[model samples]
Every structure is written in C-alpha cells, then in structure tokens.
Target chain A: MKARGGVDWMVVVSRLVFSGVFVWAGWGKLRDPLAFADSVAAFRMLPHPVFVSLVALGVPVLEWMTAVLLWVPRWHRAARWVMTGLFALFAVALSVAQVRGLEIDCGCFGSGEPTKWSVPLAWGRAVGLLGWAIWYGWRVRGRSADQ
Target chain B: MREGLREEGLRMAVMVAGSLVLGAVVNGVRSDSVPWEYEPKAQRMSRELARVGIKEGETREVAAGAIELGEFAGMVREKSVLVIDARAPLFYRMGHVAGAINLPREGFASFLERSGLLGKDKSRAVVVYCQSETCEDSRMVAESLRRVGFTSVRVFREGWRRWLESGEPVEKPS
Candidate 1:
C-alpha cells in the first residue's frame, strides 16, 4: 500500500511490534489471574491488595484492546499513543524497582521472572513507539485534509 | 484531509477518555468487594522481620548457627511440625531440608489443603522457607498461611542456601 501521507513502513513495523508484544503479554496474564495478582503485589506501590488485583485484571484488558486497536487502521494512532504512554510508565516502575534492589519480577510478561531493568533500553523502545504514533498522527491529519 | 484528521483526533480523545472512565468505575466496584491488604516495601520488610518472634512450642526461627537440617529431622520424627519448602518445586525436588514438604510459593494454597496441613491446630508451628534471605517466596508463603488463620507461622528468613551454607543437614529427594 502507498504510504498514507507520513505513515511509512517504519510506522507500520513499529505498530506490528507493539501489537505482538501486547497480545503476548495480555494472553499470559489472562491465563493466570492469581499469578498476575501476585506479581502486582511485588511492586509494593499499590497500598491495597484489592487495588492490586483490580489492576491485574484491568491490565490484560487494556493490553488486549491496544493490541487489537493497533491492527485496525482507524484506531491505530490512538492505540500507538496509549501503548507508548503505558510503556513510559513501565520504564519508570522498572527503574524504581531496580534502584530499590527489589528482587521481584517485572511482571511485563506476567511470568514472574526477574528481568534486568535497563532504563536506557526501555526509553529507547518508548521513543521508537512514540515516533510511530507521531507519524501516524501526521498521516491521519494529512489524509483528513484530502477528504 | 484536514477535516478527517480533526475528526480522528476527536474520536481518539473521546475513546481514550471513555475507556479510562469505564476502567475507573469497574476498578472501584471490584475494590469494594475485597478487603485491602498492603504489601510493604523492602524497608518495611526489614521492619516487619525485626518484629517477628517465637513463643514456646515454636520451631520456626533459628539462630545464626542453628542447624536447620537437624531441626527438620527432629520435626519429621515428631510428626507435629509442618515443614513447607517454599522454593520452586524443581528446586525442592533437587534438595531440601530433610522431611521438608514441598509447597512451591505459586501453588501454596492448594498444596496446603492437599497436604492435609490446613485447619490444623493454630498453635502448632509451621516453618516456611525458600531459597535465601533475598527470596520473597517464603514471605509469600508465610502470608498465605496467615491468610488461612495459621497463627504460628514462621519464615526461615535465611532459607535453604543459608541452611546448607551453615553446614546444616540437608537431604536429597527420596
């Protein structure tokens, strides 16, 4: 397909990558709610266990929505932006956990495996995703002008 | 094209806001259904650990030089003490405190009931330990025990690693 205004191959590739990540993550959490709740508890930020459980349940829903929306051309830009914002939050949480020397799992994939927290790597990924969102926004804006 | 862009932006805003509101409402309702228990930070963990103590008939806590292996062996002979190895099952099967029952942190609830360990006398001491001091599995298992009304639960804060490191007795799986 001809690139829609500024929505070039890079944007499409970024969207696909993020969609796959979210779908895999969402499926993992959805398979085991209690495990996800335990992972959330490890963060120690949510003062209430009930709130942690709620977040555990809601996270998969959000991931699934972002994954599905990324594939739908009409919602791709919005999904990209949302996913970028969420990843930014993840980066912050992971950085704080590392700084505190917490041995808790990142819960990124909901597998309860401890992951190395690399702030630079996380920020780089966020920037790439954010770039895609901006490009898609520009493309959508250009397409609207033609209409 | 400009109009299309404006419409998409408006729709995106409305959708994002609507989803956020819906999420908040659902979470609020869910939170109302359960009791709120908080997980303390590492600093809090240290504070909590300092407050833990043992009373009579409790075999859970050990001094730095105490032999956990001997303790487990003695408990096994008594048949009164319940020893739960809170490490992952694979690790538990590889080696553990002698007579320690494997109850990996993830499946502890079911393991407790299936092992016929639950609803036992609250005063009866239960010892739970994972890999080491840094490991959170033991803490999780201890918390699970508390949730089920086990009043005499104790965590072997320095777990199997320290147990073996201290030249304490350990046994290969049968």
Candidate 2:
C-alpha cells in the first residue's frame, strides 16, 4: 500500500513538471512564430516554405493544448499520450538534423537568444521527457484500476 | 480496440483544429502581426536559406537578387561594388577576394561600425558571399546590410568556390 502511494505521488509530481515545461515552451514559441519558423527551417524537414510556415503556426498551439489537458483530470491520460508523441517527433527531427551535420539553432525555445542546436543534448532531453510520459501513463492506469 | 482507436483519432483531430482556429484568430485580429506573414517576400527568402544549413557546393536557381559567379566577377572587376566576405576571420585571413573586406557574421556589427560602410551611399551595390553555394552566411550578412538601409544588396551564390574556379585575384590576409 505504501509503495503504491509513493508511485502515485511520483506520477503527480511528474505531471506537474511535464505540464510546466510544455506551457513555458509553447508560450515562447507562440510569441515568436517567425523565430520558431526559422528553427523549423533549420531542421530542414519539409523544406517547403508553405508547409514550414503552417508548422510554425500550428505546433505551439498543440503544445499549449497538451499542457492544458494535462491539468484536467479527465483529459490527463490523453495529454500524456500527446506529449509522448511530441517528444518522439522532436527526437526524430533532432536525430536527422544531427546526422546531416546542419549547424543551426534548435529553435526549441524560440529565437533572439542564441541556442545552437545540439543533437545529443536535444535527443537526451526528448527521450527523458518521453520516459516521463510513459511512466505517467503506467502509474495513472494502475491507479484507476485500483479504484 | 476499434472504439479506442476512433476516440484517439477524434481527439487528435480536435486538437489540431483548435490550434488552427486559434492561430488564424491571432493572425487576423492583430495589426502587429508576426513577421512570418507580414515581412517582405525578399526578407522571407533568408528564412528559407537558413533552414537547409546553406551547404558548401549546391547551387540554387538564381532568385531575383542572386548573382551568379561570372556576374560577380565582372562586378568585382568594375570596381564599382563592395564585396564583403562573410566567412570567419580565420578563413578570410587565409584568402579572400583581392579587394573584398572581411565582415564575418560573428563580428559583423563591430566590423560594420569600424568600416564606415553604414555611412556610405545606401544605393551603392554591395555583394556578399561566403565559402560556397550552401553557405548561408553571405545571405545573412547581406540582409543585415539591407536592414541598415543599403538599397542594393545581392548574394553571390557560388561564393568562394566559383571565385576560385574562375581564378579571380585573391589576397592573403595582411
């Protein structure tokens, strides 16, 4: 019983941390879509101007929604899933950019500040976040089952 | 399982739609709109170039303000234009266009201040180039010049590669 309670506490703590990170990151990107667009371009993903522009506009909103959803108990599970997908997507993009040896900013936190993209560091962070999301999913599922 | 998948898909769609609507609202209602939608088309080209790592050897189709190698050389020979090398100081020191001045991106502002190019006629043709076709450093430097009121700024797409290929005169750093 004690171990289960401890696990429940861990889940709640991780949820708060995840929600805070997404909110902060999303707010920064939303305020400076152009800078975020530049970072997207640096990733060289779509390479098409129109698509890149759409992504720059759309991504931050999704991030904001994910953060909001995490705070709502009924939608919390869905938020974890969304975050997992987002982290996985970021990890893949970072990996590709690193493999191609592109010297550009991560645009992770938006622009104006010089934050050069580092593949290793970004991947490590994304993977860590994904792990947290998974743990959140597992613990929340068990908690519900117990109820 | 089918029901779960359907629910998940619906949730994803709702999230995507919500984001789009919010973004559209912000864009439509604001006069101080984001630069992505409001900046000049020419200014946006720099964003496109910046995205791809602006490599060392690939030549892009010449855009309206892009200058090819031969034209760049002719302008240099005419001595009516300023050629700014956007490579690092070390690379500029190794070799550069015979009359080109080093204004590496890292130290561009200070160099611009010291060089007095800002006070020069803004209409004077300024050509910027870096290591190769893929190098975006030149584009960035040219945009910086444009922002400072230079009316005629162009990029030498082939940059150092074409300059060397044509055997144009180069000067070693003093």
Candidate 3:
C-alpha cells in the first residue's frame, strides 16, 4: 500500500495477484480440457455441444489472457473489466444451477468430484472473484498507465 | 474519456478474439481435444438402447419419470418404492438414502438376475439416485430398470446430494 515515483506498489502487487490467480485457474483447466468440458456439460446450461466446447476451450484461454493483460498497466482497466464479466458469468451460472437444484462441479479451476457443498462453494468463489475484479478496477482508477 | 473508452474497447475486443483463435487452434491441435459437439449422456444412452432393442441385457434408457424431492421423501418415508443407489460400493456403504439397495453401475451390465432386484414385480415403483448433481450413475441405473421391465421407473434427478443436504433420512451400515 505504498506509493513511490508516481507508482503504487500496492496496486502493482494487486495486479500481480489477479494475474497469478488466473494463471493458476487457467493452468488447471488447460492441463485437462476434456474433463473441464465434462464439468461444463454437467451444468446443463449450454444445451448445445458447440457452445459447451467453445466455453470449455475459450474460458481457460480468456483466463490466461486476462492474467497477462492485467500486467500491462495500460490494459489494466480492460483486463479487470473482462475479468469482472467472466466472474459475473460464473456467478450467474452457479446461481441458476443451484436454484434448479443441480448438484454439480463448478469446474472453476479444473474438474473434481462435486459434493453437497460444492455448489455454494463455487458460487461463492465466483462472487468473490467478481468483487475482487471490481475493487481492482477501482483501485487503479486515475492512475497513469505506466504506474 | 472517449479515447480511453475506444482503447479499452479495442483491447478487450482483441483479447476476446485472441482467446477465440488461440482456443480453436490449441484445441484443434491438441492430442486430447474435446469434441466440438457433445451428446447428452441420457440421449446417448437412449440411442445405444434403441440400437440394441427393448429387451437387451444392457437395458433401455428413457426418461420415464424424474420424481420431485417431496415425492422421493415420501417414498423414503413409506418404504414402498424400491430405492436403488447407483454409485460405487464404497459410496453405497458410506451412507445412502434409507432402505436403498446398492446396485452400482458396473453391476447393471451383469447383475440383472443375481442381484434379486429383478425378482420384484415390474409394476413396483422404482426410485434411483447416485452421488450428486454431476453424477450420472442414477440415470444409467434407471435405464437398466426400464430394460428389465420396471414399469414405474423414477429418477431422483437431484440425487444423493439434495437428499443428504436437506437432512433427509440416511442409512449407514454397521
């Protein structure tokens, strides 16, 4: 939370944190995509395989891209907004599936056996990440691109 | 502000398009890429069932009935319906819907007779469930029931997770 030379190291660290999370998240799914696709299919939201496959493939990639772009001070706003949108999407999906009484794996990072509490855990993670992205966006506001 | 918005929009769009292209190329080239189109398991199972015939040993897969929680709970209370646990033996032994018999998915392919579940009247109501929302064992087992002439086959689609999460009665073997 310190500032020096027109730069906020805290904000820089925050940016790194966001990027690190996406890198971790993306790495898990990138390692085994078919399993991730299966998790997406389990949600029963996509309804079509094409959509499911696109999401399965695209999501992890988007995550990685966000991770990298957030490092670019100039692109922080766009990257955080994208991250916000993605997390929001996850929150909505998890919420709907829970409402429908679907007991499913959130597949946020990768695939795993879903248990009774997995749904809420997934939803909470989505909401939490969404909040973080918003905060990050706000924290970096009005700062020069280089900082 | 407009210039900033434009830059933001452009960068975001580039990221989106980059993700799309990279995803497609990576997925297409990857040795273990997932299929672009997927058939829902239930539908796939049904197709396999049709390919074999109604009375095949593998059992017919059809969505006969997916009963609600209330109905399943009532059935559990009354012990009138034949409750089937479709998970593995380990999970079955752990805890299951009260009065549920362990009929794991692997057994479905072969245990049509030895399990003695087949001896029951075909018209007797049958309720099947497995691990959680993502698990498909219950559906597969339900299909086996249909193939074996179980007339009142009902699936607790929410399965074991919902039942347990709601504090429904459960059985743990001694």
lDDT per residue for candidate 3 within A1-103, as digits (tens), equals: 6565767776777777778889988998998787688788988887578998888888899999998877777777788789899989999999998998877
Each model's lDDT comes to 0.62, 0.72, 0.79
* Candidate of highest TM-score: 3
TM-scores, all models, native as reference:
0.56, 0.59, 0.62
Enumerate clash totals for all models, in the order shown: 7, 3, 1
Residue-by-residue lDDT tens digits, candidate 1, B23-67: 446545652221233333333323333333312231232333222
Off by over 4 Å in 2: A1-7, A112-117, A142-147, B31-139, B143-174
Model 2 chain A poorest 10 in a row by lDDT: A110-119
Interface RMSD of each: 5.4, 4.9, 2.1
Candidate 3 C-alpha lDDT tens digits along B1-174:
899899989989988888978998999998868777865545444444454344334433446588999989998898898998987677788999999888765534444455686567899989998876567668787876777578888888888889988999999988
Q: Say which docking band candidate 2 falls in.
A: incorrect
Best by lDDT: 3
Tell me which of candidates 1 and 2 scores higher on DockQ: 1
Which candidate has the top score in DockQ? 3
The docking quality of candidate 1, as DockQ, is: 0.23
Docking class of 1: incorrect
Minimum summed lDDT over a 10-residue window in model 1 chain A is located at A138-147
